[model samples]
Each structure stands twice: as C-alpha cells, then as structure tokens.
Target: MVHKKESINRKHFLKDVFICSLGAYGGPEAHYSVFIDQLVVKKKYLKEEELVELIALCSILPGPTSTQTIVSIGYKMGGPLLAFLTMLIWALPVLIIMTLLSFLYQFLNQNNISSTGLRFIGPMAVGFIIVAAFRIGRKVVTDKITILLLLFSAFITYFIREPWIFPIVLIIGGIVSIVTSNEKNLWTPVKLNPQWRYLVAFVIIAIGSIALTFIWDNRIIHLFESFYRYGYLVFGGGQVVVPVMHTELVQLNHYMTNAEFLTGYGLVQGLPGPMFSFSAYAGGMAARGSGTFVQVLGAAAGGIGIFLPGLLLIYFIFPIWNKLRNIKGIKISLKGINAVAGGLISVSAIILMQKSGFSLENILVTIATAGLLLTRKVPAPLLVLFVLILGFSF
Candidate 1:
C-alpha cells in the first residue's frame, strides 16, 4: 500500500500527460479526446464529469478544444509551467510531421496538385462546422437573449465579414448579459478581483504582438501573426479556422492557392493529433518557395504561433474559471458568448463554401457530410478517410 502511494506520489503529472499526448491520434475525437479522458480517470486526477465540464468550458472559449482541454488537465495535475509544457508536447509531434510533409511537397508537382481527393476536404470542413455549431448552439441558446445574440452576430458577420467583429460581438454579449441577467446572483466583491487585470494584460499583449508585426516583418513574425490571429480569435474548431486563416494566409498574403489550403486542411483530418496541425502544413506551403530550413522554421512558427495564444489563455483563465463560473452575470455572458461562437462557426461554413466556389457538388457534399457527423454514428477520422476514398471515386 505504501509502495503504491509512493509510486503515485512520484508520478510526474506533466511528463506522464505529455507522453500520453504524443500518442493521441485521429483529430479530436478518436485518440486525443478519448485517451486523455481515460488517462485522467485512471490516474484519479479528476472526476470524469469534471473533465467533461472542462471540455464544455473549452468548447466555448476558442481555439482547439483538445489543446485547451489538455492544458486544463495539465494545470490541475501540476501548475502553469506544466500547462505550458503540455502545449509544447501536444504540438511537437504535429509540428514535426507537418514540417516533414512540407519538405516532402517540394519534390512533388504542387502546381499540378494530384491530391484531388484531398481538396474535397474544404467543403466537408464547412459542413463539419455547421454541424458543430448546431450541436453547441442548441445547448447554449436557451432564451431570447441568446437567440438574438446568435442571430445578430451571424447576420452582421455574414454581411461585414470582418475578423475584428467577433471580439466586439462578444463584448456586446457580455454587456447585454450583465444588463439582462439576474443581478441578485452575481458574485459579491470578494477578496480580490483579477478578471479585469487578466483581460487588460491580454489586450496589451495582443496589441504588442500586432505592433511587432509592423516593426519587424520577418518570415517568422509573419507566420506567427497569421496563425496567432486565427488561434486567438477563432472560437470553433478547424472548420472555423479554415475561413479565417484562408483570408489571412491566402486572400491577404497570397502565400498559397485555395487548392493547396484545402488539401492540407483535409490532410490534417486524417492525421493524428490536434486539428490546428494544419497550420504547420500551411506554414510549410507559405514558404515552399524557400529553402528546406526556412520551410521547417515556418512550420514550427505556424504550429507554435497558432497554438500559443490559446495555451496562454487556458493557463491564465482556468485557475480563476471556477470562481468566475458561479457568478450569474458571468454565466449569462458565457451563454451569450457561446451563442456568438456558434454563430461565428455558422458564418465560417458559408465563407469557406464561397471561397471554395459554391459548386453544386460542393453543396451536396456539405449537406451529406454534415448529415454524417450529425448522426454521431461515425468517428471523424473514419469519416475523413471515407471522404478521401470518395474524393478519389468522384
């Protein structure tokens, strides 16, 4: 008994978790999502529902839910440092593999682009996001306020199509939440209020990062900026990032073609690890015109760049999440924010389809793929593989 206790005590929660992450595969659903849940449960690290709660919270937060979920678990097992380390471990495999794929593509005729099946991923990704939005939104859009915010956000976003609009939409939701929510249930002035400080610090860092982009427009900085913006701002999964990153990397920078973007986007679906690993592939494509070394560096920057903001957020926010969650006003705000996130995801599907040319076939695929996912019968990885086969047949 003592030996078992000692062994448990000696467990390096961070290292153990990190090692586990290296083995996670099949996007968010297959290995990453299931394995981590099992690990945390077997280790007695957290109650099953507790992890579920964390995941629910992460779904509303932004970026990759799996990444933030691991960070939160790591933080619970260790602390801030462990949380950061978990982010690195989670991303390392993806960075390496994506960079390698980038290097390999140099030998291939990217111009001809034979991955015809992979290109279908773009439309399917659109459908995937729509399905996800419905699933998430159905849970959060409880009343008129949330429904109004959801529709309002989606309407403005569909028309304006501005990346900056999301944060403003969220701010409006927060304000509406405070104004409309039951005042009696709000948390009273406690010993300390750190929420404002964290928000201010986050804003300053974001501004500083943007300023640095202007001052030093280097290869690395540019890669980071593109991904950092997407990683920080995007609320849903890869479905949402597809459109946002497309604008920043393709439309704005002209780093790669639409076909190239879709290929990588689809490819990541089949790959093991996080959904954001596609950024590393994008990083590679961005610098495919350059040397091998530069391509690898770009891949690293893209992977780290996109992953960092959310890593920082979960680390900073998770500790206080418990305190803030209980406040009625904050919960109301989160409800609104969740609705907005769903709205953003909804618009993203539309944006991706438009960017993909809005073909009848693409529309049909979107509907079919969305239907497959909504059934919840098929695993996402298998669905991706099936799509790959179908991509070839079609």
Candidate 2:
C-alpha cells in the first residue's frame, strides 16, 4: 500500500500523506508504524541513525510523535513552507473528524444521551493508556535508573497535581544523571539551528503568549495559552498529552469537567489524524457556554494553537538536525527527558484509571479491553466503536 525508491512528486506526497493518514486512523501504533514504513522502510527518506535522531527529537518535544516525525521529515526533505503544508495536509483529516466528533460529543453532553457511552469509553481510554505505557516503557526503561526515575516521576506527578511537575521531573532526572556521572548519551545541548526569522518568531510568540496570559484574563487568551502550554510540555504523544490537559483545562480552570475530558479523550481515540485534535473537542465543549460564533473561534484557536509551536520548532530545527545530534549534552538530557516521559505517562494512566471509577464491572470491561488490545484481534476504531455502542446500549 506504500512504497519508495522512485522520485516522489508533489502529487505523490499528497497521496501518500492521505493514505498514511487513513492508515493511522486505526490507532497510534498503526499510524506510527505505517509512517515508519513510509519513511524508513519504503522511501529510504532517512537512514536508520538519522531517523533515530528524529525520534529522540520528537520524544523531547511536545505533541504527537507521529505527527511531529512527519513534519520533521517533510521539513528535512523540503523546507519550512513545505513542512507547514505537510503538517496541515496530514492533520487536516483528523482536524475535521475531531471537530465533527466534538460537535457530536457536545450534543451528547447537552442531551445527556451518551453518558453511558462515555462511561465505557473513559475506562477503555485508561486501558489504551495502559497499553501505551507498556509499549513505550519496554522501549525506554531498560535499567534500574530509569525504573527508579519512572517511579519517582509517577509519585511526584500523581501527588503534586500541577503542570510544572512535568518540567520539574525532567530537570530532576537531568540533574540526577549529571550528579550520578551517568555520562550516558542523553540530551547534549546544541546551538539551536538557524532560521532566524522562524526562531525569532517562535521566541516572540512564546513570550507574547505567556505575557498575554499574565496581563489578560479573557476566555480566548486563556484557551489559546492552555493549548500552547500543552503542546510545548507534553513529551510523549497522544496519551501523555491527556494528563497535562487534564490538569490545566479540567482541574485548574474548570474549562471541562472530568466527564468532558475523559469523553473527549476516549472519543479522539478513533479520530484519523493527530491525537492533539482533542484540543478541538475540548475547546468545543468549553465553548458550549457561549454562542456558536465563539464556539467556532475557540475550536480554531484550540487546534491551531495546539499545533503551531511544535511545527515551528520542528521546521526550524531540521536544518541543523545533523549538527544538533552530535551534541553529547542534548543526547544525555534527552535520555532523562525520555525516562521522565515514561514515568509521567504511567502516572496519567493511574489518574485516568481512578477517574474511570473502576468498579468490579468496570474492572471486567477494562481487563477485556486491554486483553483485546493485547491480542490485536480488532482494529482500533472498531474496538472503540464496539465499546461505545456497548456503553449506549447498556
């Protein structure tokens, strides 16, 4: 269904982007593996070592790994404009679907018809998170230090219930590595790649957003800042972004209730593009308080804000990726960051599990869902729909 070795034209890129988006619609692993095949196996776009470098970069940055990887490769192959267009193209489908799902989820919220569905979906999302933790953990946590870091990260995240805990955990891990003389290959700091315009713009936008948040207390500003912050901080893809958003939008701001967060989280599981599109769903839910006009604006702001920074960062960084990879400091810090990411993800799973209100019956549902995922018997979308219907029917 995917191939390379021939010169790729613009038409082919678009076609491949569309096809990859469809393939990813099934689940995170599916989308990523499909993309990996497209990039590494079929296209030979990037050598294995180069691809690993990109993977580490994605792991350190925020938002979805697959989406970021796609953008990074596109930027490398082309440039800033191409990368932006590529991300827009690859994410357009999911952005639309998630927006529609947001409308539906909002309708369900208003009518009270889908609580049961959300009930099933929410815990099942925890199951998904559990699967994600296992999948990523097995890859990253190979030593006692990482194991201890995972536990420590989880303990702090679960107890602190604050967003700063993320950076704090990363810092702690980095310091520990430095102190322990764990001169392993982690994030070796490097001179940020040039593209002075993009770099300056990124810095300005970041600072401006932060400054705006402090000066103004409007709904739109708050919403955009929330999305931007989540986009910047979340290291791992999809599932990991959940807890960060949970704390900011749900717990702190009351933008969405637990029900709303879990519902959006569970629902986005079936969307075809970036998992970050949940920001649209969340924005829609929050905008329910205002009229339709504000709702649409919120939706656009949420989705765009969630996506823009990471795209900028990836595009700007790609030109110098070769040089950046050689920095020993960045390499070691990345190891710390990755370890913290694993632990943070684990904590998010626990939080979701708790919020799902696991009773004996819920237990059965969770175990069954996890088992099904483990077996790989059904596609992700179908499995989600099955649970969704089961929720509505029961």
Candidate 3:
C-alpha cells in the first residue's frame, strides 16, 4: 500500500515516531515490542510479517537494529525524506537530553541521585520483550520445523551471548528452511537497481573521517571518527557498543573517567529512545575541557556519526531488499529468518530477567506489565509513564 506524497500523513507518522521515542526503553530487544504495538497493531503501518522481515534484515546489519527497523518503516511508508524525519523524531530528543545530562554529572553526584527510582524499569522492559516474543512467536511458528528452529535459536543465543552469533544463526536458519522446504522455482532473478551512491557515500565518510582525524589532530574530528567506527563495526546494539566505548573513551584515550562513562550509561538506560544516544553524553564529556560550544558540537558530531553509517547503509540496502523480496526464494526464506529473529527476542527476555533479578516485586512488575499490554486497554506511552512514576514512588 504505497502512499502518494500528498496522501501520506507526515504529521501523524512523525507524532507516532515521537511517542515511540518517549516510550522506547531497554535496548533493541525490548524496543521491538514497542514497535509491534504502536506501529504494527495500532497504526497498521505495516504487517507483523513485514515488521519481522525488517527485524531480520536489520539484525543482519551492523548498527542499532531497532533504529534501522523504524527508519525502514518510514522509507516504506513515504520516502527518504520521511525516513530522515523518522530518525530525528525517534532519536533526537534523547540525544539532546543526554548531551545536557553530561553537564549534570557533578550535580547528580552531589545530590546523590541514585538509580533506585529506575530499578523496576529493567523488569518492565523484560515484560515488553516477553509480550513481543509471544506475539511474534505466534505469527512465525507455523510448523514443527519452525518451532524447533525457534527453540534452537533461543537456546543457543541464551548460552553463547556473542554478537557475531546473531547473523550466523539467522543465515543458518534461512538455509535450513530453504533446504527443507517444498518450494521449487524459488531462485528467479529480478533486475535490481541499487543506489550504489549511498554505499559510496558511506565508505567515503568512513575513510574520510578517519583520515581527517589523523591529519587534523582535532578533538571533535577524533570523536566523530571513533563513533562512526562504532556505528559500523559493532554488531549488537548498545550492550556491545558500551564496552568498545569504554575501552576507547576511558581506557585508551582517557577521554573521560570510567566513573563518568558508567554514569552516562546508567542514565541512558533510564531514559527513553535509542541507547545510541549515550554517544552524545560520551562525546560531550570527551570535549568538556574545550568549551561549552565545543562540547555541544562534540555531542552533535557523535550523535550524527554513530547513526550515519547505519542510515546510509539502510537507505542503500532497503531498496535492493524490497526488490529482492520479489524472488520466491526470499519469500520462502523469510519464514525461518523471522522464526530465528523471534528466538533472539525470546532469549533476550530470559537474559534480561536474569539481569533484572527474580525478586517477587520484579516478577510482579513484569507480569503486570505484560498483562496490561496484552489487555490493550492502556496505551504504551501511558503505561511507560505510569511505570516510571510507580518506580519513583517506590
């Protein structure tokens, strides 16, 4: 259902994006649930199958998977312009908030702002993941083979817990499905007019930024290079990027203290939106010695740098992906790919529950959150706000 330019409700779409940003907590795992609720169920912007396919596609990509998935939705709904707006709407507010929060480290420390108020959030996010896994699982698990694949993917991911394991599992699942399936005549090729210019732009910026950093010895350029590298090189989302950032920002360059880096990370976990927004906080801290203006510049550079590669890559690849779907082979493969993706989400619930703990209160919060979401009587944004308020009250 492609919309004409004039027919697309740009305002409505952007508003939904903002609402998602405000309520998007946890990392990509939990963010998928929010996308399913707001974008898939409520808005009917896309089907669960299409969204799952996007999830599978983005999971194979290197950057923030949830961010890429949402951006792809915008591209599908409108065009590149709407996709750009989606990225901004989904990430900018938290970026700005994180940038400002970089200046509040001292105040937070002096005032003893414990993250206690945010404790329930982790379990709440687990709730979201549980519901998403259930919903996605119901849609994707169509046969005995798919059920086994789902369980296998979840079990393997739960134990291994490595970044590279994801794409490998997804690919293996795809191959397995194709080999075992009854579908014949699945490999017809279609002419693909991929926009290689976006790929060129991505590569040029990557190399250019690195070379410029070497030649300039400027702090801001260095920050951009570091983050742009992070955006492309890392497989998993913020969890994987955190250690890399810690090594570079704290240990290697001494850009910031370990304590400061951890503080920024903790704060980011409490806030809504992409976890990549932590880049702004780190970049701001990295430029703290320079000046206020430089710090803000550093934040903007970091925000843009970390998200740029993914945006470019998605823009370049999405069109090709859309075309490729016309191949019967690709359609057949989506079943296993989506099944494995569902498994990935399923394992995340277990991992997060372990991290969040198995206390009665935490379990109750998770149960309550999942229950309310399943009931569909409450809006996600309101549910999120209520949970935050409840957490703070405790």
Winner by lDDT: 3
Lowest summed lDDT across 10 adjacent residues in model 3 is found at 235-244
Pick the winner on lDDT between candidates 2 and 3.
Answer: 3
List the candidates' TM-scores in order. Answer: 0.82, 0.90, 0.66
Ranked by lDDT from best down, the candidates are 3, 2, 1
In model 2, the runs with Cα more than 4 Å from the true position are: 1-8, 25-29, 39-50, 109-114, 184-193
Estimate, for each residue in 1-394, the C-alpha lDDT of model 1 and write its tens digit: 1113223332466556665665665445444456455555456666667777787667657678788888787777667776777777766776677777665445555565566656677787777767767776787688998899888888987777555676788678767867887678576544434546555656676777788889997877778777777777776556556656776677667898776776677666656667788889899889766677888888888887788778777866787777655656555567677777667777766676787777888888788888987787776678788877888787
Backbone collisions counted per model: 0, 16, 0
Winner on TM-score (1 vs 3): 1
Model 3 CA deviation exceeding 4 Å by range: 1-6, 106-190, 324-394
By TM-score, highest first, what's the ranking?
Answer: 2, 1, 3
Name the runs in model 1 displaced over 4 angstroms: 1-37, 56-63, 102-107, 110-117, 185-187, 193-205, 318-322, 358-360, 392-394
> What is candidate 2's TM-score against the reference?
0.90
Q: Over the stretch 1-394, how does candidate 3's per-residue lDDT look in tens digits? A: 4334457699998999999988887678778999989988888788899899898778667788889999999998888899999999999999999999888754555689865665666677667668877887897899998999999988887777554566678778789889889888899878989999999999999999988987899999999998998898655457546545665677568887654665566567668899889999999999886778999999988899999999998899898986666677766776787788778777766766665678999899889989987897775657766766887797
Local accuracy by lDDT, each model: 0.71, 0.74, 0.80
Instruction: Please write out the lDDT profile of model 2 over residues 273-386, one tens digit for every residue.
Output: 778888887877666667777877777778988887788778677777777768666556666667777888888888878877869877777788788888988777887899
